[model samples]
Target: MPTFTSNTAQINFQTFGDQSNPAIIFSNSLGTNYSMWQPQIEFFKSNYFIICYDTRGHGKSTAPQGPYNLELLGEDVINLLNHLEISKAIFCGISMGGITGQWLAQHYPDRFNYVIVCNTAAKIGSENTWLDRANLVREQGLLPIASTAAGRWFTDPFIQSNPTIVAKLSNDLGAGSPEGYASCCEALAKADVREDLSKIRIPVLIIAGQQDPVTTVEDGLYMQHNIPGSQLFEINASHISNLEKADDFNRAIQKFIV
Candidate 1:
């Protein structure tokens, strides 16, 4: 476990495989930690230097209070790279992580060789929706929202067949830090990068979940359309498509990065 200070945050991150290999930094989703990227480690470690980190306010990282924005989240990654003496690497992110990826791709183009964004959107949901969620979490807590959020994570069939997995994920969501989750909600609510798409000059791969209701396929399509020469691919799973369709997701990433 490696740790670094990023502005107001203390971030926890880890690396795998050889340092000589190309680095691929991974950012976690909103509630989950670096563990969310477990499915990718073994497959990529042999060929690439894998970097996985718990995002600010999640997992072993500090849960600083605030109305956090995408810029702050992006800065966390930049600061982490600076601390590690890493000049550049490939970036792959999912959900909240994906939004962070977009911010970096637009704002820190010099820091990445390629970018991969999965199950995310330019503007996730309306500000009011996230405000409502932040209020609910503040008043009641994550337990009340965990069940609903989990439903949006995986398809009904997958949930029915993988009850244990669903339960575990729901528990993870329920156990998230209230202030962390709420602050991220504020970040998501305020993020709208539709104008920033053209700023992505490097190669990009956009992955969408065919069944994702949280960030619809249309959202991914919008990014694909706006980013010049970007490619869009679809997975049969839901929001957490990487877990639900690990083999396909891994294969797509392996091929694209090569």
Candidate 2:
């Protein structure tokens, strides 16, 4: 396991295939970690250098106290790349990670070759909604809504076939640090990248899960409309569509990047 420490946080990361190959950095959804990309890693490792890391306060990473925003989160990625001496790479992100990808493309265009945003949006939700959810989580841990969230995240068939994955996701969400999670809630609440879309000049691929309630196909459409010449692909899955439809997701990514 490779690791990088900076700015009072430690990010645990894994590298697949070879360093000499072009790097494809992956960022996972909120409450999940690099392990969320497990399905795609093996498939891409032979052709591309893969980098997956636990975002701050997720997975093996330490939970640092933060009122985290997109800029800070984006900086974390930049710092990791700097530490690795990586000049540029492709960015692949899901959900919250997708939001981060948009931010990176907007604020740090020189550092990325392409960005793949899956199941995310320019603005996550209203500030009040996130604040309310954070307060609710603070008052009553995430355990209560774990099943509900999971239900919305995956299709019924996926849940039926992958009970263990569902359980792990529930555990991850339920076990998240309240402070960290709350901070991210604030991040999501305040995030809006529509105006920044024009700043990104790199090729972009927007993949949306058609059934995602949190960030629907409309969200991907909005991104496609906003970013110049951006591409969109919709799959018949829920929020964590990459897991439910990994083959399609992987194929789309391979085609887009090439």
Candidate 3:
């Protein structure tokens, strides 16, 4: 694991597999950190160079002031790639991480070969809702929302059967600095990339969860419709489909990347 300073933030990240392999970057959902992509890391590491990082405010990465924006998050990844001397990569992300993938695809098209966006929308929730969450998390920490977020993340059956997995994810999520989480809340609040999706000319794969309350299947459809050559697939899970249906999730994208 290494830390890359991107502007004001020191991004914490881990790389897996051989450096000679083609690079592929994975971004986590808002609450969790790079460790969330462990399953993907283990699966893809042998064939593709895997780079996973903790977004600002989560994990061991630096969380700056509140009210963050998508540009900064996108730049953080770009800077990290620059630090490693990687010209471009394949990017995949879930939830808020998907939002970051969207930003990079549109604004820095030269930096990626393709993007896989999972369980995310061009514009997530309302600004007011994000503002409220930011205020609450800042005052009371991530514990309060962590419980509710768990429900959105895992289906009931998975939660009951995989208690240990649920508990560890919840811990990694709630462990982040409140200020960092709140700042990301602000970023989500202001992030509305619906109109600019036309700018993303690269190939795209949008993954959706049938039971995802956070971002519905329609959200994935919207992205698919907007991105010219984009494709869409759905799984029977919640927001964190990658975790609940790891094999299917990994299999769906293998065709495209391989």
Best by lDDT: 3
Candidate lDDT values, in order:
0.89, 0.87, 0.90
What stretches of model 2 exceed 4 Å from their correct place? none
Where's the lowest-lDDT run of ten residues in candidate 1? 164-173
Clashes of 3: 0
Model 2 misses residue 172 by how many Å? 2.0
User: Where does the lowest 10-residue lDDT sum fall in candidate 2?
Assistant: 141-150
Clashes in model 1: which pairs? none
lDDT of 2 by residue, 23-132 (tens): 99999888788988988898899988898998887778876876778887888899988988899999999988999999999888899999999999998878999889
Displacement of the residue 205 alpha carbon in candidate 1, Å: 0.4
Query: What's the distance in Å from true for residue 68, model 3?
Result: 1.0
Candidate 1 Cα RMSD (Å): 1.0
Model 1 alpha-carbon miss at residue 176, Å: 1.4
TM-score of 3: 0.98
Compose the digit string of candidate 3's lDDT tens values, residues 1-258. Answer: 589787688799999999999999999898899888888998999999999999987899988765789998888889988988999899999999998899888998998998999999999999999999999998999988887777989899999999998999988777778999999999999999998888789989999999999999999999999988899999999999999999999998788777
The regions of model 3 sitting more than 4 angstroms off are none
